[model samples]
Target chain A: MTTSPQNSADSRLPLVIEKNLDRILDTWISELQVDGGRLLNLIRESELREQASRFLDLLRKAIKVAGVNPEKTAAYDELRDLLDELSRSRSEQGFTPTETATFVFSLKRPLFRELKEAHGDNDTTALLDDIWQATMLLDRLGLNTTEVFINTREAIIQRQQQDLLELSTPVVSLWNGILALPVIGTLDSERTQTVMESLLQKIVATGSDIAIIDITGVPAVDTLVAQHLLKTVTAARLMGAECIISGIRPQIAQTIVHLGVELGNVTTKGTLADAFALALKKKRQKVQDI
Target chain B: MYRIPILRVEEFLLVSIQTDLDDALAVKLQDDLTTAIATHHARGVIIDISGLEIVDSFIGRMLADISTMARIQDCHAIVVGMQPAVAITLVELGLSLSGVQTALHIDQGMRFLRRFLAGRDEEASDERE
Candidate 1:
């Protein structure tokens, strides 16, 4: 393990890459194919070759300007950008982090072969130093791809959470002056805020006098959930719309009693049908057999 | 001293707050509304806050006070047309205004007041019989 001076290793590294660009790419592609798992069938050979060649071209340019550690310098911005794009696209195509990183790491083997071929038996220390620098550079780039891949997955999760928040709290109009909000999940403070806001907004938009908050889809009844339900009911009532909490399954009713949640004044019923019947009666309308 | 207008519609005194009510204006409206309730022999008072974009705790307290005072004078106070945002703010501020009767619009407010007054009138007649 000879520690060659930084300047000599940095200067010689880019020359080795530039001299054997095509040979390095050919070997890198074959290396990727050998190790490729499900990802081999997912992406085509031509597109993969184009991406690998572009990455190598930018890498050589970045290394020439910013040495082996091109991460901090602006010269490697294009190289980093290409890696970011590759990571994001691969993530969207359902590629695992290991598969995405293999693309960058596979280049190391090909470059090592070319480096060995370029520096024959003479100058063995310089050859080892070059290999070390190339190893460091490829490792950094592979780690960068993994970082971007993980980030892309996190962003997708965050966006789906926002989408779920909007999709879940839908306030439907059941009658002329009635609205029904069917809650379907756990009532956290944030989700409760969303549920309350949407229900209140719909009440104002529809001028609904009576709102039935059917908790049939709600899996459990906790004190916090009860508080959120009460808050939604109170806000609706303050806006001049009375709320009736229906769909109290027997188990939920027992849970409510055990939790000692006071659903005070806000009417509750066994089923949506009974609540709808009461709402109709309040509106002076009746549903009978035709 | 800017005074909020109080329009008398039939047996109900209608107060539509069209502007943001500062402390003094809100107090003045509360004072004038109680006086108008007495002068017009109003059976009910409907305070419409649909035009109000913002309401602080002071204004919320004044609304509750007016409702309680109207009830004392045998006049029902129904706050009508409260904006959803204002209602949420009031609820968040821990002011439910539980004593004040509420309706979605002026029309609903009138209907509610009529039913309430009619029910009271029947009870009074029943007491006499």
Candidate 2:
């Protein structure tokens, strides 16, 4: 049987979706935050820049096949241009500015392994020094351990800052095209977006009826995190996923309770374990009812 | 990083932490100090904070917790290296740490611990008689 040209193109549609996922991630990092290097710097090394471009090409193709975006393809392109322009003048030194751009982009594989296995003194002082110094430099904060903690909160905030270009979500997973996300750390407007896209994609792909998120890792429940989390659950529901929340830390739980914001018919649990358990139970109940 | 203003010489353990005590690191400090103090029966603990610009509630609470925990184990905790702003912020956070000693410099905290240890040794000697 001969396959029509259109049918062949349609077969490659998954490939296109995979390419779009990379585009989405790139745009999200470039536009979502303002502080630190998130693809906002250039590798002054000509060879490395060439390498980055090839990497980008590979990523775009893979993302497109994943059915990566909803309405973000054009925006992703625009953000890439903006980031490319920003990095065009930067030197390739300073821990590979391109690799440090975002956790996903710069440290996806072998390079990350290189960082992990780099040798140091076989002592606690050396190991702690390495981790603390690296963390501080990456977050652009002061180095003080075992005493002053002024920089930790600042560093966390810097990591969580939101720009319009990136999603508000930090963690996204797709199982059989159903997206489930759990966002830890502080949520800014930008991360909230990444979360939404992940959830929506899962809804579309898996026809998912449930998404459970555990917020126990969040340091504090600021208005932005609360609002963003609320928005994501609502959006998921619209796409036909029942979003469940688990792992609300005591401090954050107090803050949310104090804020007196009604959670608008969303489910809550003590932890991600509980949330998933609830999801399984609900799914089972549905089967029984049927 | 705050410049080390106080260096303490102690008979058993030297406790000097030269960083701002934020919640995340404070947790680390709390763990480290508890171990160091126990292992050494550290008569002196010096915390330097001159490098800090701000101190939030979490860190403050952790400091208080560390101080109490150390004292319970018969180890004294001393706080040093506080910047002006950091000191002020902790005060405003409604956190008042009792029994946790603070000095303007690490040297002073050391001297206090040294003196306290000396006094304790003297009492032990007399009690042996």
Candidate 3:
């Protein structure tokens, strides 16, 4: 199978890829196993072999149909789809972006070796041209894998954040006519809305006259946090529930004064215990000293 | 055509809004409540809105207006049993109903009225003395 450069110049590339397809796949798998990264543990050996074989076959077909520039052609659509699915699943399976990207990058060595073996040493110019084209195609595909992987990871992170927002703002009834809302984590506008909604709902459900908003779990208090707290307090008051803001740490007190954010007529206490005591007082219920 | 029933309980007038009110009914309720406050010589008014789930700006303003009308007639108005969603809507609409006093339930509203009237009675007796 020795043909002149003119006979097999532009079209010989795809044929060469098809001819050494098996050797390239074998070399790629052996290299992945030898590298022995966390990819091996996250994915089973059989599964990895299946994906690797499918990827190589699709890639060879795409190159044959689309010539050296597979990425620009519609023929590579299936190949892109396969890679996108692989990256998304890898993200779901807890594989890092590096590992996902490495799956495509690892194909480079076997392909370069195949191109070298397909051409003789005298045809250095042809060998270089083939190597450059292969490099460009693989780089594009590798980048695509990374882009999809990052998107999947971002979606996962967003979902978890929403769940965390719901979980952190829970309102519990402390007594017959009193409710307590313990807020943890930073208070953003979105989270403040959740806090207000849950707190107000509990107040109405329990018919609680007094609400103690405990923020001991909140790490810091800025002007924005102060504003959020005030908004929640005002909403509760409008529902006929007097709001008592508790968990005012010493630092928070200083911060409040420094920010010049007035809490107005809303009552504030140093601790939840003190706030509960005040709520009872306002309810005209006396706690007999034991 | 639906008239919100205003029940007189001792020194306090009790009004429970159980259904969605149209513009005409809401205005009628205000007139009826104010008339009841005067006719019954009530010292306090308690409006139970627990059944009222949606309080648009129109309804919120009506509530505030009722409270103010009752107050001008020498009666303290307490809006009780306001749902969480209603309160949020009121606040978002920028109608705080600042003139109206609030309580969590009818019983609490009664207690608040009793305390308030008792304080007023003491002041009256002192003035008489």
For each candidate, give the TM-score of chain B: 0.97, 0.76, 0.95
Q: Write the per-residue lDDT of candidate 1 for residues A19-46, one digit (tens) a residue.
A: 9999889988999999877767999999
CAPRI docking class of candidate 3:
medium
TM-score winner between candidates 1 and 2? 1
Give all TM-scores, in the order shown.
Answer: 0.86, 0.31, 0.72
Give the worst 10-residue stretch by lDDT in candidate 1 chain A: A2-11
The residue-by-residue lDDT of candidate 2 on A1-290, one tens digit each, is 33332232323333432445445344434332333343334333344444345544543453344322312455234434434433333322233343334432332332222223443334334334334333433232111110123233344456555442244353455333223466656767666566666555545445455677867656787776777777666444322346788888787778888988667667889977677667777665422443
TM match of model 1 to true structure: 0.86
DockQ of each: 0.73, 0.01, 0.60
CA-only RMSD, every prediction: 3.3, 29.0, 5.5
- Stretches of model 1 off by over 4 angstroms after superposition: A1-10, A116-129, A163-167, B1-11, B18-43, B51-56, B118-129
Q: Candidate 1's C-alpha lDDT?
A: 0.89
Best-first order by lDDT: 1, 3, 2
Per-residue C-alpha lDDT of model 3 across residues A113-203, encoded as one tens digit per residue: 8878888787877787777877888899989999999999899899999899889988888888889999999898899898999888877
- lDDT by residue for model 3 over B73-128, one digit each (tens)? 99999998888888877777787777789888899889889989899999999999
Q: 1 or 2: which has the higher lDDT?
A: 1
